[model samples]
Target: MQTAQRKSLTMLRWMMVASLALPVALFLIAGYVSYGTTYEEADREIRRSLDVVHEHALKVFETIDRSLSEIDEIVRDLTDADIKAREQVLHARLRQLSDALPQLKSAWVFDAHGRPLVNSMLYPAPDMSFLDRDYFDAHVKESVGTFIGATLTPRSPYQGAAFFSISRRRQSDDGSFTGIIQTSVLPDYFEHFYARIGRAPGSYFALRRFDGLVLARFPVTERSAGPAPHDIPAMAADTDRLVTETSPLDAIERRVGYQRLAGYPVYVSAGLDTATIRNRWLGTMSRHLIFGIPATVLLIIFLTLARRRTEHFYVEAARRLEAEDALKHGQRMEALGQLTGGVAHDFNNLLTVIRASADLLRRPNLPDERRQRYIDAISDTVARASKLTSQLLAFARRQTLKPEVFDIGRSVVALRDMTKTLVGSRIEVVTSVPPEPCYVNADAGQFETALINMAVNARDAMAGQGLLSIAVAPASDLPTPVAPHHRPPLGYVAIAVQDTGIGIPQDQFSRIFEPFFTTKTIGHGTGLGLSQVFGFAKQSGGEIGVTSEVGRGATFTLYLPRVAPSHEPRSEAAGHAAPIGGRGMSVLVVEDNIDVGRSATEALAELGYLTTLVDNARDALEELVGGASRFDVVFTDVVMPGMTGLELAEEIRRLDLNIPVVLASGYSHVLAQQGTNGFELLRKPYSIEELSRVLHKVAPVPHHRAPPVAPNSEVR
Candidate 1:
């Protein structure tokens, strides 16, 4: 009776198992099948949408081409006219064309001398001197067709709107050259067209020169003042073909579609809102879950009773695997941090060398133009160093900021040129700056560095085969400069660096800005990028926020305070010569770094000052104390091994009370003391001019006279 009962129970269990398994197995298979079909259909829809988008883009290009062609024909007619009668005909034609083409702000004709033949204004006889603009010079060499200038809003003659010039060469019927025809297009016309092309929010449409200068944009902001993308590699590879790519801009996924103008090499790009499309899919997916989850749960419950042992084993195994993965991740992160730190240190040293060497190259002996070139080189090198330092600081949390009011649009335009060095030849950078000035008060240098680093991080994430987009604009509805609780209005310049690379893992987003945290392989990332951005934003009295996803991309924003209403950014003189002494005097120079010390001494000596060199601050004090016939000035390094230069300066004051002292340091804080006769400070790696000024201020030696310096033009 017991054996019979056990057999009956076993049979019942088997039947229960089959009953549960059949429904779940069937449902799972059916669910997978449905998913496969849905995925295929969705993909097809996306492709179809993309095709439609492409076709619309082609039409837009064709329209622009047609408009340009019409302008070209007009230019030819104006050029063929006789020079003597050019002014009258040009005036009549310009007026007619301006009336005919409402898109035009004005039209004019310019002779070889850049003299305006006819102006489109009511009072057409304005001074021709102003007519000799860049457009005229650009058209002077045009063999055929027209050249379009970057958009500009003429504040005078026309007001309250932006405009860009298109210049076409004029040739006579006999092939002789006459004047050139020019037309200025109002921005609103193109802006309307741009708005229509991809009306989806977060989409980007822009016109850029082959060199990456932004010509026009649909949505604009203050950050647009910075650099945009136009690297040689991407553009070089592009011919007259339409290319589609992907990137992240503003923390949103985007698809870029571009075509070079058929005749002109100008590049026009449109960015599709990937998130919008993905969101549409997500909504669909969410709907499936609403229905599918209950079905799945019911099936699981039915199966669970019969296959409880199998379920237990599967769950336990998954938990163990997750633990193992966590352990491996921790080990990997620790290794990456160490590697990133070491690399940053070495890179910093190299940057220091490059910066210092560039400074050295900018000597007074060079020609004014060459000196300017070297100065530019030095500027470029400093910018590069600043970028590297930002990366290190972002990684290490040590960046300092010096804020100023600036146009973000200008800055981004400039940065586009620099992206090449950071990302190399593989990545292309694109930018869109609004016509409205993006005014913000922040550390311009640091802000720029933040943008560049973000770009580099994006590039690295992309593995050098993607597009990096930067967009600058005023933050909408951001607080004004003085809202105590709200961050002061930075005019809210938003710098967004986006990339179409492998994106951040959802679980790792918060850690991205943490010191030494990374999602990269063991040696790939030190994970300081977002952190430095965070630190930089906080230091500049700004904020940083990010949005990212796995397998998509990321966008980082840095918001800084806008310049105060009453405050305007001061225009700095390109270079200042340190004022030399009115009377010659002997200066005692003390520094431990031989190279720095020697350079200082030599530069001082070159300025006609007698210099005494010592190895440290103590020797400097002794030299001053050892004589009643003391040196006129003491220039000493602030930091040394034993006694700091500050302590030594104090000792010298106790002995030779009247001797003037100027403290120098690589770090600025050590030279903080002021108000005493011995209280002047100078920064190291200073130029000869800087040293001369320090001496003149501290020790006014009676016989000292400044060396005759030529004007800036004569510096070389």
Candidate 2:
């Protein structure tokens, strides 16, 4: 019995030891993986910083080259006598050029013997000689196309400021060096630019010649503008793209990128302090250690206690889980309620417009002008309601899209007036579109709706006062994928809406697209606007993205797949014309709703068409097949209780009936599921003019000389 008890105690001790060692091993592995990830991210950030610096440096150099070229052209045209005669005019021109370019400290013309012929500042030309200047020496010996020389302080008139000369050699028609046109650029100009771009304390950028002579450096020290150290690393010499080493000037480790400026012998380099990189990594690691150590310790303690009171812990955990599930259910219910309430509110407003317009139209003594106004008001309200329904369908991912290839840039330009009206007068609307068209294949209506939605969102963000800009351009790179399985295509056309407003908070990024998620006060917004835009972009084979800084602004970009130029779709304006009158045309109307069927039948009859109405497709088919009724056209709704209108149309084709069919619907999942088979589709709440036009398109009737028939008699 004593042996058995001792063995049991030993096993228990081993089990406890195993439990403690497991968490430590796992945590250490996790820490290693996390640290490696952070290091790689830091390296990538360094490369990005280098690219930005390189671009800025290239711009500065280009400006210098252009200034020198202009000076060379002006000097080459003038003879020595012309320069002496027109000296004042020449000086005025140089001063103008200098004033235009803040980077240019001064401009001067030098003779082959290195004497200043004309200076940009002051008349009578202050006597100056560039005999010892490298730029002048190079030009005098041989024609130097363009050369940047060492830093020098000017003499007398231009004293007290350090300037580097960028010189262009001027030649006569005989191909002999005439003179050098030189422009002095202030090093402080570049220093300020570098300072703006470099955010970190120790981070710096430098411009150096091919031979390692430093021209400019940020955090300017006396040694920085001098020659580079003899022990300069190979990365800073020649055309080495990027390297990580200890900087010779500051004796600090840095990761640097260097590039030779295009058309110039000098190189530009940007470096980030290795100490800053390491400090960032250390801070991240410290945070993990701070939370992770205690969490691990607590986990171990909990596991030990859980093993002893397993049943009790399980009961408590089950209760907590139940409570969490209940909370989640409540949250879901709230979201659903919000969505429904928003939809209802918008629909109610639309109904108010329609109801008020109809009530005003019923007034007996209304003038012809007032009558027309009420009629137009009702028509506009119906169109608005249709748009609302379309947006709701888009949010539900069931909108029946009529995709066509069109120029996106042109389309956005066309919306400028409408966008201005939507956002109102307080906000300024600006548009930037390329002169060349960028074509994309998408539903034009939905695309326009998306733009309108974005503009409204921007207006709201600005609180009714700000600048709203809409820009369309071809994207160089694919947009970031919004979903894990989404693989972006090779190219896209981006429509971006930018605003100066109170920007979005970082924490709301993930929830911005949720159906009912919003930051606006209740009754101020519905929050389905962005959701519709998101769904439309995805369903149209594209993606949307947003970038915002807390106090700066926000830009929302919609990326649509680009289409070939040859496939430019026809515009809607081209399809509309004066409505043609129907003269005793026969028609078959099939609709499921009683009120809709009655109204349609009466309207067609009033328009001089003999009409027959049925509630379902089967009845309409029976009437067509069995009755002695001759029909010129068949008009039907897309969705119904039995045998959908699309199917009915298909059957008519199968039966070889020589009749045209027009399908109409408010919102049809069927139209989205099974596309319309070449049948003309008229969206619901269509105007009488639209109805007449579509009928004339499918089946035409000549004018009748007989008197107008009564509506009740015309309906059969």
Candidate 3:
């Protein structure tokens, strides 16, 4: 083990050394590659600049050549007899050509004797003897095509300034040379044109003849326009269009591009200073090194630290995973505890009332009025317990829903009395609703319960003495309040409940909607109130929001999706007499719990229904299939042993039995999960009045005396 450990340590040290050395090797390779690329880019840019300058220079030379050709045509047509007559015409044309071209210095016609016949600059004509000019001598000897003269200081009309001439041989109709028609261009013309090309300060552009005599140079001086030095390389090399050369005039190193102008003996060259290119490349390389060095150093430091902390990292990661598991488990347990405690507390209260009432009735001396009162109290307490369970189911999103489109404004107005009662006389209740009805699709009872919950919360916050206001409006008319991780509805009908009370704090906002998360002291609140409201909003495809500032007031708004108005009014079952009895109609009670089954059967019997109780869905199915007894309605619990009530209902349907099925459940996911399959559902802990109403609606006996009320009627 000790030998293995030594070898492992040596291997790790080698690996670390290799890791550090690899980046350095890569850095050196990258630097070399980058330098090559930078050099190529700089060379490309210089060539591109040279191309632009060459194009401009080409245009200048072509213009000059075209003007010379035009002059030759005019001179070719001139005859001795018509020379005096055409002199004025010829001079005017030459002056027009010179004026049109900024580069042309002067235009003139010379006779075979080398004497100027007409000059464009001197109006009437000057006594210019051009026989001494090199261009004049060339035209007199071998005057055939055009000839570009070397740069020289010309006398007379040119003002003794250095200029070059492009001369074309003028021939008579017999093809005999008459004289040369020449145009002179000063070096300043090229200087001004080159300046516009916008090269670097040290850069240069030059026009030179085929024999290496420079005709024009940008930043021109007397010294720049001269013969090329013997030491300079040949400018017209076929393979060397681009080259690096030191200027004879300034001794500055430059990258030069050369191109010979077409139809002329002159060549144009554009150069870029090599020093400038080198400086730019160095700047870029320096920047890369400046940033890369520190980054490489930091990487080495990080690797060293990472090796040192490897064990610690593993330990911390394991600890984090354990902590996360514990936190999630704690959350699940807390939620479960809150739900169980709330349900237990409510059911225990109802049991206490029922137990007390039964004990009172057991007394032999109990008065008839007192006995009836105790029974009534027991029934009312059971009804309250049923309502509490319904609210809890709704909060859990498991309750069966009967959604309808109704006017939200009218619903708020209908709840005015109820809101007043909930807040009590100490708090003033106010309501504001638009005259125009706003419609929404939702379970009306659940919506009312949510609204009442909001009002009650508001009342508690106000200490039951502040003002409580309920308003109904279109969602478009209200400013939507922001909530963390909640999406606002597009189109909705907003119902806002506002109160003048001690507002909720910012720290408790996220937890306000959690189950059993109440700000009130224990026994004063169940904390499921807001939870119910929150669940109702989400299940209805909407959202809920709250806005509160401490010491000011609080407002809770419920936004429900808006629906198009329907012409038909919603028919409600309230304000009608409920059916009192089942009229001896038979019901099949299928429950897994023996006590629940017996109690349900007894309740149905009390409602004038003959109920046959069964312990499970299988027993109930056996009786129905054997035809031992026929039931008017198949009233069965949703969850049962052997087979489920939903499956039993389906079997009854397959049997073609005309009996209606009513399902009941204390709390089951069947209604929320698999759906109701069109069967009516009655929540557990139902009252006798509710059972009677359901029985009469499903199967009413002809002999019954009481008239049937709406199935949805409540004993509010």
TM-score of each: 0.38, 0.53, 0.51
Candidate 3 residues 1-716, lDDT tens each?
A: 98999998797787578557855776678777877776676567656766776676677777878887777666666664456567788778889898888788789877777777876776667655678778877776665577888766656554745677888877776767687788888777887777877456556677777666777776565544445322243344434446878866667887777776666666777766778767766777788778877866775567656445655877999999999999999999988998788788878988999999999899998889999999889988977887777777777787777678898888889889988987899999999999888888898888988998999999999998989989988875335544422333446788889999999999999999877778888689888889889888878878888999998889999988787877777756522255477666767777777777777666666666666777777777777777634567778888876788888999888888777889887777767766778887777777666667776767766332322222222211
* Top-scoring candidate (lDDT): 2
**Number of clashing pairs, model 1?**
41
Q: List the residue pairs that clash in candidate 2.
A: none
Model 1 Cα lDDT, one tens digit per residue, 1-716: 99999998897677567666655675567666666664455445444444554454445444444555664565554442343355556466657767766677777666666666666664454544544466666655655566777666554444546666766666667655566666776656656666775555555666667766565655653223234433222374354333334432334444455556555656666555555555655666667668765765664556546356656877999999999999999989977966677567646665776676577675657677766676766655655554555555544434433446777788889877888778878888889888877777666666665687688789888988888888877774343344443554344667778888888887776577776566667556556566677777776657787777777888877776665443554545225544574345777777787767677666666666666777877676666667525467778887788987888778877775577778876453333223223376654455566677767766655434323222121211
Using lDDT as the measure, name the better of candidate 1 and candidate 3. 3
**What is the lDDT for 90 in model 3?**
76
Q: Candidate 2, overall lDDT?
A: 0.78
How much is 656 displaced in model 2, in angstroms?
2.5
For candidate 1, which ten residues in a row score worst on lDDT?
Answer: 707-716
Ranking by lDDT: 2, 3, 1
TM-score of model 3 vs. true structure: 0.51
Error of 2 at 121 (Å): 84
Q: Which pairs of residues have clashing backbones in candidate 3?
A: none
**After best superposition, candidate 3 residue 40: deviation in angstroms?**
49
